[model samples]
Target chain A: MTELRLMWRNTRMVVLCAISAALYAAVLVPFKVVPLIPGVTELRPANAIPIVCSFLFGPAAAWGSAIGNMIGDFFGGVSPGDLFGFFANLFYGFIPYKIWEIISRGEGPVIRSPWIAVKYFAACLAASVLCADFVGWGDNLLALRPFSLLGNVIIFNNMASAMLLSPFILAAVYPRVRRGRMLYEELMPEIKPAPMPRKTLGLALLVAGEVGAWITGNLLSTGYWTPGFLPAWMAAAPYDKSVAMIVSPFMLLAVVGLCLM
Target chain B: MKTTLYIERDSFVHRLHPTAKVFGLFVVFWSIYWVDNPLALMPLALIVLAIALMMGAWENVYRFRWFFILIIVPTMLTWMLFYRVGKPLITLPPFYVSEASLMFGFGRGLKVGALVLASVLFLSGTKVEELAVGLSRLGLPYRLGFTITLAFRLVPLFMESALTVVDAQRLRGYDFDAGGPFERIRRYVPVVVPVFMGALRKANNMAMALEARGFGRTHRPTSFIEYRMHPRDAAAFAFLLALGAVSFWIYYSGLGAIPTG
Candidate 1:
């Protein structure tokens, strides 16, 4: 996460960040591979760009993903929910490389074997779930859309791109980036990983918190399960109060976990 | 493709200080966020329309006509699934169409539509540089703001190069539209790889160019354009502040809420 701040100090990292964002918005605006939710979202192959860039550019990719999505939102429509969308994409790009760093034990994200492939999928899934949860929880909190609708669709949209497109892109681009000595670790060697025990615990919390938020968001938004602790008024239809009450702590936990990592 | 929503207009809205415009954007979103009644949302919609008409931003608005429709319709339908209140006018399996639900859904749609319109107006009126300057004035770091402005400048370039790659591939008898949705997306790998590699090849030189020109030699690098607050800007800020206050008052008075009985 320190890299996120440090990347700004280096001119090359700033250029790389701009390039990453430009590539994302370029692919995002013109290409609508599949429209999953009409105006809200689509199955964007462009989603893979962040994951690919994340493996290559580290923190730059995270900011790139956020800003790129902001550019895309400008073209489509911007809303208060897009503030959430921004952070959602930030995590979407941030989580992959961080998780990969831990799970792969400092190895590159180019998938060369079955075990590596599973780890790759896990990283993408974690990223996708948190992204979906953030957007879903936000829309539902605002009473704009049901959490289940966005929560579920975005996961599918992100995963579709990650699973089907990102690996191929990474496999093709990683070695060349490494050869050019342009990978984040190569560009900014000052960044040191946290102790393994803390990072592992952070990973555990991240997974648990994200998964909990997803399930709780879905349940609360659907009116399937209302927690008894909330007042009756808060538990009523639209369930905005219920969602704010129940889902937010999990989201906080996830953020704290990311900070730890 | 035209990558940005900005139009080169010399309207009063365009001439306003970037910080005021940025704050205006937040005020609009803040105003819209407090209401969930279609009727109540109409005033802001009409205000946006008036601004658009005043600024001759109808071109961008007209361009996004279908998108506005798409946003409104699906949003209404999606809320119908979850906002089950009032007497059922039409009871379907998953959807319960009631007066409250219909009004609530329409209100949500209008709210989202208004937010989008406000954003479109903002983007149409504001340039990328102005946005960065506005954000910087509002406390964004200089480097991050520069990165954002640079990314905006690069989107069209990247998109142009990507289209060139697609054309070259097509000339070589490569079919981009040769299969199902996922297959079609997968086929973009070739197009993406070249653009990705091309972008990276520029990164080193771009960094060197910035460094040679003293990119980060100082904390607050001077800009080519300078902005100062005017009487109009102060007036606009006051108007926006009042608008935000009125919105909160509406919410507190419960005039913005849907009657779900």
Candidate 2:
């Protein structure tokens, strides 16, 4: 998180951020022709760029992901919900490298072994779930879209690209980026890892919060589970109030956990 | 490839200060967010339509005609499935189409559509540099703004580079469209790798160029383009405030909500 702020001070990180964002928007704009859900979202192979950039550029990638998505939205159309979309994408790009750092210990994201592959999948899933939860929560709260619709679709969309496309891209480019001394670790050696105990706790909290929000958001939005505690007025269809009340704490937990990390 | 939705124009909307335009965008979204009834959303839609016509932005609107339809139609259908209330006019297994549900669905669709249309109107009239300046006027960090403008500039270059790579690959008889969806996506691996590597090769030199020019020497770098607030900007701000107020008043009066029961 500190790196997110400090990266702006370095000219190289700023340029890297621009490059990452440009690369993402470049891929994103052309793929608008392939709609997955027809206007709600598309078959975004560009989703892979964030994860790939995350492993390579770290904090710059996070900002890049946010900006790139904004650029994409600008092309299609934008709404108030896109403000949330922006942050959701920020975490989408941020979580991968951060989570990988915690889970991979010293392993690169090139996916050399079965264990590393599993870890890679886990990292992608965590990033995807949190990204989905944030967008779902925000849209539902605004009564723009049901949580279940966006929540499930985004997870599938992100994971598909992360799993299918990111590995090959990273494999092809990571060695070159590392050799060029452009990897975030090489460029920003000043950033230190959090203590293992704190980061582990952060990972636990992040996973708990994200997964909890995802399930709870789906159930509430689909009207599968209505809590006894909510007033009747809050338990109606659209479920915006219900979602705001129930899912927000879990989202907060994830943010807090991310901060701790 | 055309990277932005901005139409070259010198209409009053186009001449407005970037901050005013940015504020106008926020005001439109705020107004739309408080209303869920299609009829209530109609006024905002009409206003956006009027602006588009005034700005001669039909090209961008026509470009996104299918997208607008896609957004409204699918949203209506999805909401119809979830919003079950009132006397059922038609029951189709999992979906109930009642007056209440129909109104709710249509309202949601219109809301989403109007939001997109408003953004389209904004982008049509405002340039990328104007957007960055507007956002900066609204308190965005200078570096972040620079990054955004820089990313906007880079997207088309990257897209052009990607096309060149695609052309080279096609010449070698690589079939991109001949595979299943997953395999088709995998084919992009070759296309992405070269563009990615090419982008990374520039990052080091780009960073060096920025530092050489003393990019971060001052917290508030002087802009080459200056925007002074005019009387029209004040009037625009007042009108936007009124728009936001009227929409909130519609909600406060219970006129913007879908009728239920």
Candidate 3:
């Protein structure tokens, strides 16, 4: 609530949000032609923008990422399920800053140590999985494609790009911003802590959810079980197989994310 | 070379109200999904193509023809293979092209084609400012619209500066091309960091400038321009609504379902 108030009341935050979204979109638009799954997925190096900017500008970056992704989708070719993309990207952008605050213990977000790097990477994976799940469910709801396929593809694409690029981006930006005394922490007279407890239950739920996905994926793959509730289109061939293949990595990531938290 | 998605044209499509175009985009996309028959999907592709032809998007289409060959074509082929089920059309020793696969493939393909065509037509014909105006008319707060439009305006500027940053790095003997994937990504650190910092500084300056000019000083702000619905826009909206209704009716009536056998 305070974050929204800060964004709305402060002219600086509003401009920052606009800049973050525009810059994020601008960086991403050129990559529109490179299709990972044609209409379904693309090589989005711009995912790094939210990961980096969230740490730098907080909620402004989060809103910017959501709006920017929607704008980018418009330029790239807006499709039916892109409404999901908008909301999914909102989580993608917002989660990192909050996670960073929890992990950083108010020392601020800089990946100077191995532990910090692990936390940052874990945050990236968690954000990617969450975004992918949201987007995948949206696709299924709209009958755009099978949810599992879209989810796996989105997760792989976003995680790969963010992991590959964010560290370098953060390493580069941190020192310079600090030198200029322009870091988000520096600009604000007081920093509000994120919503409480930060660790126990949320981390536990995330682990349990990912473990469940792993189990479901394995069962579907082995043909030992098939979910009766899913529609024929969604439960059809190759989706179950693909989901099985994809879940292991996410489960591994869940463990890593749990440790980071 | 300056990269731009918008094509310069003065066609009737360009003259249509931006709000109508934005709304019509959703209607058309929704209509696309209700279609499951391959043959029935052709008209959707054709309508968008005809609009593209009128808007002179063919040249841009030709220039980006690789997108169709590389992305769209492969996507169609993949769907055909995966959904193979009906009477065989062609046989390779181990695989058969069947009616169900062909129909399903073409349907998905045409949907993608129509999506791409519509995006090209709309984006080429419309300006970002007009999009913001359309959004505002649709009841988005003027401040939000201004922020979005402002973001759009900044995209080109940021892209240009990012390129400049890349050029500067190249001048510093940075070897971005010779490395393995990870190494190459690491090389981008030099490029992305400076660009991000530059953007941050620019954002700060822009905020100050906007604040000085009375940005966010009021709860409601007046705009110098407004978009009024024209007779043509009304006709366009009616046409879209009618088409969308018919499509939904056809889908519910089972006329557009793909036959498996």
Candidate 4:
């Protein structure tokens, strides 16, 4: 029993990883509201779960987070990226864990901040973005077809989605997790949190939102929402056509202007 | 004894690379689309089944045998009625089953069923790693290859998570297996929410872990998992080439000779 206690003590880390997988899969798939939620668009934030898991429990836990979500999502009949979706999620899990222990530990306020909570929050958020990119590229390459994972449309949608959703989650969960208050009774005492200027998080959100809006307009207005799914020219169809109509003179002007110039 | 959908064996088909298997499947699918002669397609389908058997995939076939049987019965009846539609040999009040219609339906169904089974044969047997290896070999990048491998690796992990979640629900007095569709759906929320949450957490952790690690550190790293092509691989590749040639020949030889299933 005592042996089990020692084992179970940190095993919750795996459970945390599992929960992370399930949530990402559920929010992105089976339930429609995730997309409806506005900015939490891409499957990349899901990367954060494995990131934290890797930090706390190592590779196995991180992997578990990736795999666990796929299984959960499949049984739920989530959107069909088929095999590509599952693959990106798995390898991406290792990224965050490896980063913290290997490289990022020496960097910035991330390491020096008195409260470990904000540090963890930021770490996970970063992990998710990188993985999301992995999903986009990997999906196109592996599937031999574009638009499997994030593709341009979803990736653009996800960027908007991430800014809106990530911070709230970071704020709500980071303090408890960072302080170690989430551990089972007997793990350890909670760590103190560091003070931050008020509304700093708000400013981050504001900036992210503006950027998201700008990109969405540019990407969507083109009427070609595909990055990999559709060729850039094809994806730029609506924009091209609309812009063509808007600037049809360029065609006639190009011949005369180039000749004149 | 059960000549079910999946044919488990240790023949050349089984020995084929997972990537090759995927390619083969696609070729078969493409062939089906091109061949209008159902009869000719039947033989090809049978050949695929035979190859599957040679590969020692009978166990997998047996698992889905009942499903095929269920499909076959309905299909046979529909074809029989269709083939005899105008000449209805039997008539009942408010329900007249035509022999022509029955024959047509049966034939249509058998063709579809056989194809579905053939697909199942491939899906159940091929390991995801093999697929990744194949795709990578076929020009997918290492990142994509690893992504596919990682995805395949996650399947078992998610399955295990699911079992635990089921057990947890059981402990909480939730009846997951036995219920009406609505009940089944409602029960799923508990299952889904928890599972989705699990995935989300993992994605975050993984991203952080990856960043911490040196993933995407350089353009590309030397591959540790290398697949060298030997003479046997060349021979197999040649055989597929020949198969493609024959398929093209059949297409060009004449559309009329293709038999209808």
Candidate 5:
């Protein structure tokens, strides 16, 4: 009951985390637009979102984000892997949450303790990469076919990807979240009669969603040339996915409603 | 490329119970594997294709039909010509085309190609939300079911955002119009780094939004969309199940003949 009240008290913060997680999952459709490069990989970013979600929001958040991203996978026409689909994302996507869980238990926050973040970072990174690779390899082994070396190729590439990517999601947003938590503590000292403007709230959500999406789209693809083709091969590898891209709007809106929390 | 299994339209395949069709697909696929003779596979493929076509995916077929034809013809030719290991039906010195090989090749090609088509037809024809709902009805947790539905909606949204991100970079005088593929990739570094960071921010926000809406605990959701089982759906399920049984029997009993022997 106390934890529930605490969640209710910081409901706004938690809800934002969920929405962020949903949008994190939501965008990234694999629609086969022009690629910026010829052979550059895309899946790493897809893996990042859920990890980030789990890191910030807690266990429920982690699972929520993974389920969201999986939906995108389903629609993007992921058919061949069969039941392997169930845990494929879980193995790769659950790393950051686990790491964050460990980190959160330390003396201070993950950001202040950069070494704390780094301590298990390598193991976490290696674990996720290997988990993903083994799943792929297992699929081939089951099929009684020659194994693919592509898994190793991907693992090698992700080293730079992790070093470059993980910090920002870990550092910037998380601190803001912690600060936001601080703000939540400051503002909602007790549940006062806060003016709940339903219409105003709806319009705010609309504007925020559109504007946030526009900024994200424009900010990410800063100009590179690739000739457009009809059969646009989807080039998004793994790292580019997020929460907004996947989970249901009804659920998301509810989370958004919690921002009213 | 991510697989394309959805077939877009309001036909029987579109309307059939999502669970049944999922099972139906599995049944058809196993039948493809079970039938020892390749000749028997074609009819099963044809039946799936017919269902997909009847479901209103004619346009998608026209779009990918050439690609399919190209793949099937070449594979058939290669299998019959190169993998020929038996007594020659037609010999060219060291290279010989045997009756068994030819039959095997055709059967393999037809089965594989038809399976591919069946998959494409399924994805292109099916509405993603309906599929999620069906899964939920089939006993997927409602939370997970809704997550799948939301993620489906997000794919296109993100695809569009990715493009918009590219254009935003172009306007900022980012050298998208760079020479050589490598140069273009370097240019996209600026684009990708930020788009990715921005997406994380979005996910964080989305998670928070969802949690705010009284989402964590079980609350009776006011579902805005509804799908009900109808007579047409029942009939399709019964007929397809029967067809699947027949296919299974034929494959196992070897009543189905292949042209090879």
Candidate 6:
């Protein structure tokens, strides 16, 4: 909520938002030709923009990415896809910043070592999984596409393209941004402190539940799993339904646990 | 800077309110997906194309001719080979493309083409300032609307800056195209890093400029422009609403389903 408030109170953040959106669209619009999956997904190095911007500019990047995607859609053979595209992109641009606080553990972004590189990689993977899952589900609802294909394609495309390019970009630009004193931590001085243990545990459980649900849902929908793959107690129940039933409890527990904390 | 998509033309489409055009876009987008029959999809595609032609968007469409062919051709082939369910007409060792799938793919291609045409028409017809006015009137905060408009305005500036960075890197003896894929990507680091740092500097200067102009002093800033709904705009909205209702009815009734037998 403070992030939202800061966007409104600090006029500078609004300018940052505009810059993020423009940069995103500029990267995306030109690359519309490089479609990896044709009508479903594309070769978007533009994916790197959101991940990079989120780290540098913070929550304003989320709003900027969402709006920029809508505009970029106009030039990229526009579709109702933006209905999901907007939210998926918001996640793409927002999650890294939000997760960075948790993953970085009160430290600023630095990649002078292998361990720090792994942390950034994990955060990128998590963001990619979440965004792809949401977009895959939405595509099924709106376009009657099966879930497995879009899910995997988006996950591969976004994760591979963004991750492959982002660390290099991050490493190259971070020092300069830090020197300019324009990094998000510098711009927004009232950064939140490290999370409490309860919050951390809850977040971990929530992420696990969602990722588990995504994998199980895809496997079940595609009929790729065998009964022998499941335990006897769970084999009789349909995998999709059973996975949802079991994992959803963890999601509920996460929310309740976070609230109590 | 060459920023906007708007083309100078006097036509019915160019005269409508931006909100009405946005609504029309929504109607077209949703309805296109609801159609399941290849034959039924053709008319919808034609309707969109005809509108674009009437609006003098043929020149703009011609500019993207190669893009359309490249995207739509592969999209059609992909669906035919991998997606549509039917007896195989053409089979390779691991893949089959069926007759039903071909038409199905063609229908999907048409849907994509229609959408691209609709978006081109929308962008070419609506000015950025008018879009901002329409968004503000549609209940978005004027400040956020201003940010989106500013983003649109800045897109060309950023693109120019990106080009300049690339040129500067080339002058420094960095061969952007000389190496294999990975090495070429590595070479781009110099270009991307500098452009991003330049952007951060520009953002800081922009923030100072906005502060100097007393931007955030008032909670509600007054705008010099306003969008009003004319009678024609109201009629356009009514037509779009009716189209949406009919499309939904057809979808729910399965009136547009392809006959399998």
The residue-by-residue lDDT of candidate 3 on A1-261, one tens digit each, is: 246446656667778788889878877876342457755567667777888888877777877888898778766566767787887777777667766666666655666788887888877776777777666656544534545556677777777667788877877777776787765666665656544554544565555655465445534433345567666554554353345344545544544443334
TM-score of 2: 0.99
Between candidates 1 and 6, the one scoring higher on DockQ is 1
Candidate 6, residues B159-190, lDDT tens digits: the string is 78777877787788776667554444445556
List, residue by residue over B1-261, the lDDT tens digit for candidate 5.
232356445666666767666666666666665564666776777776676667777776666676566545554554453343457876665334777666655665565466556666767756666666667666776655555555445445554565678789878877665675333333444544455455545654566666776555663365667766788777767876787788779866776645433
Native RMSD of candidate 4 (Å)? 15.1
Docking class of 5: incorrect
Cα lDDT computed for each candidate against the true fold: 0.91, 0.91, 0.69, 0.44, 0.47, 0.68
Per-residue lDDT for B1-261 in model 3, tens only? 333467777787777898998897778888888897867777777777777787787776676566655545654565654554687887853344787766776677667666666666677777877887877778887677888888877888887877787778779877666655445544556666766777787877887888888987775676676667789888998999998998899799988888888
Q: What C-alpha lDDT, on a 0 to 100 scale, does residue A258 get in candidate 6?
A: 27
Candidate 6: regions farther than 4 A off: A1-5, A31-35, A38-42, A144-146, A190-194, A220-261, B1-4, B81-100, B217-220
Q: Tell me how many residue pairs clash in candidate 2.
A: 0
Candidates sorted by TM-score, descending order? 2, 1, 6, 3, 5, 4
* Model 5 C-alpha lDDT per residue in residues A1-261, reported as the tens digit of each score: 122234333444444333433444443343222332112124334444444444555433434445554555443333344344344344344444433333344332244556765754653453345443433343332221111222343354334334444454555455665665532224345534224364346334533432343333222221121223312222111111221232123223423432342
Per-model clash counts, in order, read 0, 0, 0, 102, 81, 0
Docking class of 1: high
- Residue pairs with backbone atoms closer than 3 Å in model 2 (clashes): none
Arrange candidates, best lDDT first.
2, 1, 3, 6, 5, 4
Docking category of candidate 6:
acceptable
Q: Which 10-residue span in candidate 6 chain A carries the lowest summed lDDT?
A: A235-244
Q: How close is candidate 6 to the true structure, as a TM-score?
A: 0.85
Superior by lDDT: candidate 2 or candidate 4: 2
TM-score of each candidate structure, all chains considered together:
0.98, 0.99, 0.85, 0.47, 0.60, 0.85
Give the per-residue lDDT digits (tens) of candidate 6, residues A141-245.
443344466667877877765666777888787767778777766777885644567557745764774476477547643545534655643532123343344
**Model 4: CA > 4 A from native:** A1-261, B1-11, B14-19, B36-38, B70-104, B141-144, B177-179, B245-261
Superposed model 5: Cα runs more than 4 Å off: A1-54, A57-69, A80-82, A99-121, A141-160, A163-174, A181-261, B1-8, B33-38, B64-116, B175-222, B254-261
